[model samples]
Target chain A: MKQTQTLNHPLDDLLRTDRIPHIWCPGCGIGTAFSACLIAMKESGINLAKTAMVSGIGCSGRGAGYVKLDSYHTTHGRAIPFATGLKLANPELNVVVFSGDGDLFAIGGNHFIHAARRNMDLTVVCVNNFNYGMTGGQAAATTPHLARTTTTPMGNPEMPFNLPLLAWASGATYVARWTILHARDLAESIEEALQRRGFSFIEVLSPCPVNYGRRNKMKPMDTLRIFKEKTLIKNNAQPTELGIDFERGIVLGKFVDEDKPSCGELYDKTCRPSLTQGTAA
Target chain B: MEPAVLTGEHYMTGDEACAEGALAAGCRFFGGYPITPATEIAETMAARLPKVGGTFIQMEDEIAAMAAVVGASCGGVKSMTATSGPGFSLMMENLGLGICLETPCVVVNVQRAGPSTGLPTMAAQGDMMQARWGSHGHYEIIALSPSSAQEAFYQTILAFNLAEKYRTPVLIMTDEVVGHMSERVVIPEAKAIKIVERTRPRGRKDRYNPFEPGEFGVPPMASAGEGYNVHMTGLTHDERGYPDMSVECQEQMVNRLVGKIRNNLDDIIRTESHRLEDAEVVVVSYGVSTRTAYAAVEEARELGIKAGMLKLVTVWPFPERQIRELAGRVKGFVTVEINLGQIHLEVSRCAAGLAPALLVGHCGGTLISPEAVIEAVRRIV
Candidate 1:
C-alpha cells in the first residue's frame, strides 16, 4: 500500500499533506470519497484562492481540516449555514460544505432544508456512513431501520430520510448520489454540481467498516462487494423511488438539474426596486 | 456606493438604533432569527441592509443565525445577530464555538423575562448572569449593557470594535424597555465613526501561524478566500491552529482565551461613576436600572444622605478593583438590577467583607423602582 502511494499525487498541493496519515481507520470509504471531492474541486475550475470548505462535527467533517483551502471545521451540524454566510458575503468565492450524514441530516436538518429552499448557492456534500461514526456509531437520522448501532444495540427502529428527494423537494437545482466504488462518476457529478447556479447536493454512500459494517457482520471488502453487485445506475430516477437496501438494490445517478435564480439573484431583482440609494459610508 | 452610516439625528427605538449602529460600524452581514423584543433589530436590518449593500438573512433558528454570523465574520465581513432570551439560550453553544475559534462577531440580546420564555414582551435584566456564564465553559466574555436608544447606538458600535480588537464574540446585553422605547439617536457621519477591522495576515501565508499572539494576546486573522488555508475548530488548538489533546495544550489554549480579556481589563472594562467621591453609601447598577438608580441617588441627596452610583457599561470584567476601593471607604453598597441578584453577587464578591452589600431587585418582568433603590440605600447606610 505504501509502494502504491506516490511521492507526487497530482492533488498533493490541494491537500494538507503534513496532516496526512489521517485518523480514518483502514478500509473506511471516507478517504475514497474525500479523494473524489479533491479531484472534483481541482477539475471544477474554481479559483483555489477564492474557494473555501466548511464542515461540521463527525468523521467526514474532518475533510475541511485536511483540505488546503481556507476551511472552517465548525460546531456540530452547522456547516450548511456557515457556508451560506460565506457564499453570501462574497459571491466571488465558491463555498462547499463537506460533512457527514448525521451532522447534515440530524441536528442540522433544519439548516439543510432552509438553505435548499432559499436556493442558496452552495455545494453540500454529505457522506452517508449510515451512523454517527465519530461518537462510537450511535444511531442517526439517516440510520436505516433495523440497522444496528451503539445507540440502537438491538437495531435502529427509526425511518431514514431519502436524501435526494429531500434535496429536490427543498428546491436544490442539482442532486446526485453515488458510492465510493463509483469514484469517477462521483467526481464528475460533483464537478457538474459545483458549476450549477443554485444549491446543489451530492450524497456519497461511504462505508464505515469499523463502525457500521462490522456490527452488521460485513467487512470493508464485503460492503464493496455488495455495492458492486447491488447498485443500479439510473439517471433522472424519481427521488421518491430512491432508497437504500443492500438485499434489494440502490439506485444512483444525477436526478435533478434545472435552472432557477439563486437567493442572492432573487434578492437583487425583487428587493432592488425598494432599496433607497444613499452615499456609501 | 451608498453610505453604510446614516448621517443625521432621528428618533428610533434601541433595536432600530442597534441595526443602524451595526451598519455604521461597517457590519455588512446580518444573520438572525426573529425573537420578541429583538425582532425589531432584524426588521430594521432587513429594510436597511440591502439599501446600503449589506446582507440580511433570516436564518432558520438562533443557532444557525449565530453560526452564519461567525462564518461571515471569518469571511472578512463584520457581522452581527440579534435575539431575545429563548433565542439567546439557543445561541450559547455556537457562541462558545465562536470564542474557541476566535471569530469576531457581535451578538445582541434584547433581554426579556425568562427561566424559560417567561415573558416575551416584558422587560427584564434576567439574562445578565446568563450572558457571562451561559456557554458551559470556563471562558471570559465581554458584555455591554445599554440604557437607552442613544446608548444602544453607540454601544453597538463599541461592541463591534471590541469583538474585532479582541477577536471574540461581544454581547450587547440590552433589555425590552430600552429596545422598544423610542428616543432621539444622533447618527454621526461615516468619516467620524471609528471602525476596527480584524488584524489580517500581513506577510507570507505559508509561514503564518493562525493562533500566534503578538504583543497582544490576539493573532491576526485571515479570512476565507485569502488563500491562508486556516483551520479553526471548537477543540483546544495550538498556535498552528491544530488540535492538541495534551494537558499542556489544554492549559495553553484555555489560559490564552481567558487571559486575553483578563489581563487587558483596563483596556476592555468601562464604567461610569456619579457622586461617589464623598459618599457614605453606593449603588452598583447597569442597564435601565442605572437610570432609576440615578433618580434614587438624587432623592437620597434631597434627604441629605451621601449616596452615589457606579454604572457599569462593560459588565463582564466587572470593574472589581474600583468596587473594592470604594467598598474600603463607603459604608455599604447597594446593587440595583432588574434580576434577583446577578450583578449584586458580583458587587458583593468585590466588596468582600470590606463593607455591607445588599441587593435591590425583583424576580423578573418588572423594573426595580427608584424608591426601592432609595429604600435599599437607606437600609444599607
Candidate 2:
C-alpha cells in the first residue's frame, strides 16, 4: 500500500532556505522540530487568518519571525502571559507559543507552571536543545547531567528537568515528547496536542548543531543518528521502563490525555453571568 | 454661573456619585479589581452595567483587568477600570501602552495615602505627580479632578469624551473623600449628553497604518480582522507602525503626542473662577479639597477678606495660560489638596513668578476641613 504524506510547501518557503548553508549545520534537530510545527499547523485545520504565533527571546523564539503569520516577539520569558492575553481577548483565535528550554523552564518557570495549572486553552511547543545556543551555549535547566558546554566547561553539576512529567503533574491536558529524527512522529504528536481542548505541551528534543554538536564533539549528522538510535517509542512501557541516560532518550507518546475544562470555557460558564441568566456567587 | 442646571443637592459620597456618572455616560465595560475607596465605583458598575446589557469582568489581576478593558474598548464598547494607589501603580505600564497605541480608555484613581500600602481607606492626593509622569517616557495626558460628587459624575462622562476625541487615556484623579462621599446628582437623558466615537480611516484597508496620524494628530483605529493589517507597538513607531528608533522619527512622534494636547490647551483645560472678578486672595484647590475651599471663600466673603476660589476641573496640561492671565490681577494664591504641596507647585509656576503660592495639605486619610482652608485664605488675604 502506498503512504500519503502531507508536505507543507508554504512553510518550507517561509523557512530560511537561502541560509541553506544554514547557521545550523546539517543533521541539527532544530530543522526537525521546525518541520514538525509546520506539519502540525497544516494538519490541525486551524484558520491561519485567526491564528497568532507568539514567542519569547531565544533561538527558538526566532521561530515566530520565521512563520508568515500574525506574530508577537515579546520580552524574554513572557510569551505565556502575552499569549494568555491574546487568547482570552479573542477566544476564537488559535494562539500558540514557541519557546526554548531556557525561555520556558528557567526564567519563565513560574508562568509555565501556572499556565499549565490554569489549563488555558493554548498550545505550547517547547524546543529543548539542552543548552542556551544563542548566548554562547550556556548550561540550561534542560541540560542533561554531566553535559559539557561553555558554562559547564568541565561538566554540568545541576540535575536536568523531566519536562513531560512536570507538565503532566502540573495539570496539562495533553503531553508528548519526540526527538528531531522522528520528524513525522513529532508532527503527528503536535497535531494531536493542538487538537486537544485544554493546555497542550509538546517537548521537542531539538539539537543545537553550533552548540550541542561542537561541545559534544559530534557532527550534525551524528547528532541526528544518535537521536534515531537512542529514542525508544514504547506503547506499553511504563514510566519506570524508560531510563534517564542521555543515550536512552525515550520517545514518549500520548503520555497524558484526559478531558478537562479549559480556562476559557470555565470562565464563560462561571464568571460571565450577564451573557446567560445564571448568577455568579 | 448660568443659573445652575441642577442645584441644591446633598448627602452623597464621591465614589457613589462616580458610579452614577459612569451610568449616565453609558459605560458598558467595567473591568476592575476591588480596592478600598475605589470599591464603590466597581460595585456601582456591577449593579448598573448588567441592567443595560453592559459587561463587567473581575479579572485575575489589575494588569489583566486594565488590559481587558482596553481589549473590550477595541471591540466597540466604552470601558473603564477603577483602583486605588497600588493598583493604579501596577496599571501604569499598560497605561503607557494605551497612550502609545492610541487606545481610548479611562482609569479612575481614588487617591489614598502611601508609598506602599499606606491607609487603605484613608485619603491623600499623593499621586498628583504620578498622574502626569507615572508611566515611563514622554507623552500627553488628560487628567481631571472633581471636588464634589456632583462633579465626579459630570467629570467621568467628560473624561470618556475627551479620551475618545483625542484617542488617549484620561485619568479621573479623585481622592478618597470625593470618591467615597455621598451627594445628590441630577441624571440627564442620554440624548442630552454628547458622546464621541473614534475616527475610522476613510481610505481602503491597504493604505491604512494604525499609527498613521491624521489631520488631528490622532490616528483612526481599525480593530483586528477588519481587513486592515494594522500594526501597533509600545515602541516609538513611524507613520506605518514600524519601529523606528532613529532620532528624526522619535522627534516627530514625541512632538505629535505632546502637541495634540498642548495646542488644544484652551479647549481641553477647564477651571471655575469663583468671585475672582475683584478679589485680593485666590484659593486654588481640586478633588474634595476644593469643597472646603469653596466654603472658605464664602466665609471670607462674609468677613470682607475678598477671597475667591479657583476650582480646577482639568488638572493636566496645567491650564497655565489661564492661570497666567489670572495671575496678572490676583494678589496671592493659596493651594490646597489632600497631599502636601502637589498642585501648589503648579499654581506657583503658573503664577509667572508674581503671586505668592501657599499650600495647605494633610498627610494621610481625613479631609483638611473648610476651617483650615479659611485659615490659609485668611493668611494669604
Candidate 3:
C-alpha cells in the first residue's frame, strides 16, 4: 500500500485519506461531529491502538470505517451491545460507539436505555441530524414536531425525544448535548465523557444536508446557522426550564454530571473471585 | 460383563454439574441471563465463579451474553453462556459471528419445547437441527449431548477443550430433563483433567496476521491491545482478517474452516458402542433419549434379538465414519431422540443402501421410553 502524508496531525493520518474527499456534502454537520471525536481521542491520551470504534448502520456509522482503529461496522441499532461486550471483555481498553439519530433512537432505542441503566463504561457519540439521512430523510424519533421529511411531508406528528434528559434519567453518569457549530466545546465535552468512568452520552445536533435539508427548505449551512442562533446554553438549567421547541432549541450543555460506580468496576469487584481462582497461576 | 466402575459422587443437577465443569476447565468468565432449566447454570456460576475469583455477568439479553463470552474468550479467558430455546435463538447471529471471527467460546442450550414458547419448563430436543444450522452459512460445530449429570460435567469440560483446539464455538446441547434432574457426580481435580489452549505466534508481532492459518488451520490468537493489530468481523475475511467478498477468497476461507474439522474427523467425532460385534441390529441415540435406547437394546438382547447400542457423544462433524462402520454390520438401525426425527435423517443418509433406519421420536417433552424404542427396533428387525 502506498502511504502519503496529508495533514501533519496524527488524527488526519489515522483517517482513510483514499476514501476522503468524504461522501458528506458541503456544509454537512457530520464532518464537525467526526472532527470533534477525533480531537477528543487525541486530547484524552487514549492509545489509538487500544481503542475500538463500534458503529451501527448509517452515515455516522461510517465513522468506524474512516478511523484507523480496530473498528467494527456492526448491525443496525446494535452498536451499544457490541461495544458493551468489547468494554466488558477488557475493561482496560477504551471503547466508543458512533451512531446516527435514527440508528440510535428509533432502531436501537432499547439498547440505549439498557446500556445507560447498567451504567456500562462506554462513550456514545450520537449524531442527531433530525432525520434518517441514509434512507432519504424519513421522519426520525429525534425529528422535532412540524419538521418536514419524506415520511412526514406535511409535518412530523410524533414528539421528539429529549435524548440528554432520557440518558440522565436512565442513570448515565455523564450526559451532554451540543450542535455542530460548537465544535470546540463539543470536542471538550467528548473528552470529558471519554475520561468519565461510566455511561457517557454526547448528542451532536448534526445537519443532514441531503434529505433533512431539502425537505425542510433549509440549506445545510442554514441548518447550522439556525442551530447556532436558536440553542440556549445554561450551566445549571432544570429539566422543566429547558423546554423543547422547533424554533428555539433547549439549553445545550453538560446536562448531567455525577459520580456513580461504573458497571465494569462493580463487575470487577464482584466477579474477581472466579477469575482470580481460575487464573491465579 | 459387569457394570463399568465409576468414581466421585455428589448430589447435583445437570446445570450445576455443567457450571462445575466450566470451573474445572479454568473458565474465568461467564455471561448469561436467567432462563428456565438453564438459570441454574448462571446462578451457580455467579456464586461459585466469584468464590473462585472468576467473573460472572448477567447481560440484558442473550445477544449481549453471547457477545460478552466471545469478547472474554478473545481476552484470553475461557468463557461460556447458558440459555434455553428463545434465548438460544437470540444468540444465533452472534454465534455465526463467533464462528467467522474464530473466537473460542461455549454456549449451553438447555433444551426446551419451542416453535415459539412451546413449553418453557418442559424438555425437548427441538433445537437439535438448529444447533447445527441455526447460524447462517456453512461452518463446522462441535456439539455434545449428555444423558446424566456426570456426563454434563465431563462433556462441558470437553466442550471447552474442543472450542479452544478448534477455535470455534462448542454447543452443549443439554435438555430440561437432564438440566433439572439431580444426580451424584464426582468433580475431577484440575490437574487430572485435560486442557487445551490456543497456539500463540512465535516471531515478530508485525508479521503476524490473526487469521493466518497454522499447521492445524487454526491461527494463533492474541488479545486486543496485546500489540497485535487484529481485525475480526462476521464477514468472510482473508488471512489478514480483511473482508474479502470475492469468490476465491470465499472459497479459501470456507474450505479452510470446514476442512479444519473434516480433516481431523477422528479426533472431533466421538461415540460409544455396546455389544456391536455379533449384533444383528443397532439402536443409535443421543442426549437423554440415549438412556432409553440403551435399556431397549439390553431388553432386545434378553429376547435373543441380536441388538446393540451406539450412543453419539459428539453430535456434529456427525460420527459419519463410525455410523458407516456400524451400518455395514448391523442388519438394521433404530434411531431415537426427543425431537421429531431430526438426527434420524443423518442416520438414514449415512446408512443409505446398507440397511433400513427407523426413527423413534417424541416432541415437546422428555425422551420416548425404552418400550417405544424397543417397538421401533422390533419392526425394523
Candidate 4:
C-alpha cells in the first residue's frame, strides 16, 4: 500500500498529506464521499482561498481535518450555524458543511431546517450511513426502520428522515440524493450546488461495513450490489417520494432546483445603507 | 461612511448603549436570539448593523447565535451575541469551543432572574459564577459587570478589547436593571474611540503556525479566507493547528489556554474603590448591586462605621489579591448581590478566615436594598 502511494497524487494538493492515514475504519464509505466533495470543490472553479469547510462531530466530521483549506471543526451539531456566520460576515467566501447523519440530523436537525428555511447560502453535504458509525453504530435519525444497530439490536422501530424530502420542504434551493456507488454523479451535483446561490443539500448514502453492514449480515460488496441493483436514477423526481429502501427499489435524483434570493442578498437589499450608511472600519 | 460612534451624551437603555458600544468597538457582526432584558441589543443591531455595512442575524437559538458569533469572528470580523440566562445555558458548550479555538468574541449576558427562567424581565446578578465556570473545563475567563448604562457602554468596548488582546471569550455580565434602565451615556467621537484588532500572522504564510504565540502569548490569528489554509478545531491541537491525541499535547494546549489569562491577571482585572481608606468594613459588590452598595457604604459611614465599597469592574479574574489584602486590613466584608451568595462565596474563600465575610444576597426579580447591605456590613463589622 505504501509503495502504491506515490509521492504525488492528483488530489494531494487538496489534502493535508501530513495528516494522512485517517481514522476511518476499513471499507468505510466516508472516504469515498469526502473525496467526492473535494473533487467537486476542486472542479467548481471557485477560489479555494475564499472557501472554508465546517464540520460537526462524528466519523465524517473529521473530513474538515484532512482538507488543505480553511476549515472549522466546530462543536457537535453546530456546523451549519458556524458556516452561516462565516458566509454572512464575509459574503465572498464559499462555505461548506460536511458531516455525518448523526451529527447533522439527530443533533443538528433544528439548525439544518432553519438554515434551509432562511435559504442560507451554504452547501450542506450529509454522509448518511444509517447509523452513528463513529460510536460503533448506534441507531440514528437516518437509520432505516428494521435496521439493526448497537442500540437497536431488535431493529430500529421508527422511520428515518427522508432527507431529500426534508430539504425540499424546508425550502432548499437545490436538493439531491445519491449513493457512494454514484461517486461521479454526487460530485457533479455538489459542483452544481457550488455554482448555485442559496441553500443546497445533497445526501449521500454510504456503507458502514464494520458497523452497520456487519450487524445486518451484509458485507461491503453486498451493499454495493444493492446500490447497483436496487436503485433507480430518475431526474426531477418528487422529493416526497424519496426514501431509503434496500430490498425494494430506491429512487435517486435531483428533486428541487429553483432560484430565490439568499438570506444575505435579501438583508443587503432591504436593510443596508438606509439606517446609518456604510459602517466605518 | 456614516459615523459608527454617536459621540455625544444621549439618554438610552443599557442594552441600546451596549449595541452602540459594540459598533464603536468595530464589532461588525451581531448574531443573537432575543431574550428578555437583552432583546433590545439585538433589535438595535438588526436595525443598525446593515447601515454600517455590517451584518446582523437573529439566529434560530442561542446555540446557533454563539456558533455564528465564533464563526464570524474566525472570518476576521469583530462579532458578538447578547442573551440572558436560558440562552446563556445553551451557549456554554460553544463557549468552550471558542475558548479552545482561542476565538475572540464578546458574549453579553444581560442577566435576568433565573434558576429556570425565574423572572424573565426582572434584574438579577445571579450568573456571576456561571460566567466563570459555566463552560465545562478548568479555564480562566474575562468577565465584566456594569452597574449603570454609561458603564455598560464603556464595558462592552472594554470587553471587545480584552477579547482581541487575550484571544479568548470576554463576557459582559450585566443585570436587567442596568440593561433596561435609561441613563446618559457619553459616547466618544468615532476616531477617538479605541479599538484593538487581533494580531495576524506577519511572516511566511506556509510556515506560520496558527497556534504559535507571538508577543503577549497570543498567536497571530489568520482569518478563514486568508489563504493560510488554517485549520481550527475544538480538539486539542498542536501549533500546526491539527488535532494531537497524546497526553502531552493535551497538557500543553490546556495549560497555554488557561495560563494566558492567569499570567496576565493585572492587565485583565479591574476594581474601583469608593472611600475604603481607614474603613473598618468593606462592601464587595458588582453589577446592579454595586449601585446599592455605594449608597449603603455612605449610610454606614454616616453611622461612624468607617465603611466603604469596592466595585468590581472585571469580575472573573475576581481580584483575589485585593480581597486577600483587604482581608488583612479590613475588619470584615459585606458582599451584596441579587443572588443566593454567589459573589459572597468568592469573597469568603479569599478572606480565608482573616475576617468575617457576611452575605447580603437575595433571589432574582428584586434588588438588594441598601438597608439590607448596611445591616450585613454592621453584622460583619
Which 10-residue window of candidate 4 chain B scores lowest in summed lDDT? B372-381
Clashes of 3: 10
Per-residue C-alpha lDDT of model 2 across residues A140-224, encoded as one tens digit per residue: 9888888899989898998888887778778898877778777888899888877777899888887787887788876777776
- DockQ of candidate model 1: 0.64
- Tell me the TM-score that candidate 4 gets on chain A alone: 0.95
- Can you write out model 3's per-residue Cα lDDT over A1-281, one digit (the tens) per residue? 89987656567656655446666767678888998998899898888778877787888887876765666666667778767767766777788898898888888887888889989889999999888887788998988888899999889988899888788778888888888889998999999988888899999988777888888888877787778788888754665455466475657888787888888777655555344345422
**What are the clash counts of all predictions, listed in order?**
8, 14, 10, 2
DockQ scores of all models, one per candidate? 0.64, 0.14, 0.33, 0.73
Which tens-of-lDDT digit does each residue in B258-323 have in candidate 2? 887887888798999899889898988888788788888899899889999888898897878777
Give Cα distance to truth, residue B124, candidate 1, Å.
Answer: 0.5
Which segments of candidate 3 are over 4 A away from where they belong?
A1-9, A12-28, A47-49, A133-139, A146-156, A239-245, A268-281, B1-8, B245-247
**TM-scores, chain B, all models:** 0.99, 0.94, 0.96, 0.99
Best by lDDT: 4
Over the stretch B83-192, how does candidate 4's per-residue lDDT look in tens digits? 99999999999999999989999999999998987899999888988998999978889999999999999999999999999999999999899999999999988888
- Candidate 4 residue-wise lDDT at B357: 91
Score each candidate by Cα lDDT. Answer: 0.90, 0.76, 0.83, 0.92
Cα lDDT of candidate 3 equals 0.83
For model 1, the stretches where C-alpha displacement exceeds 4 angstroms are A1-6, A273-281
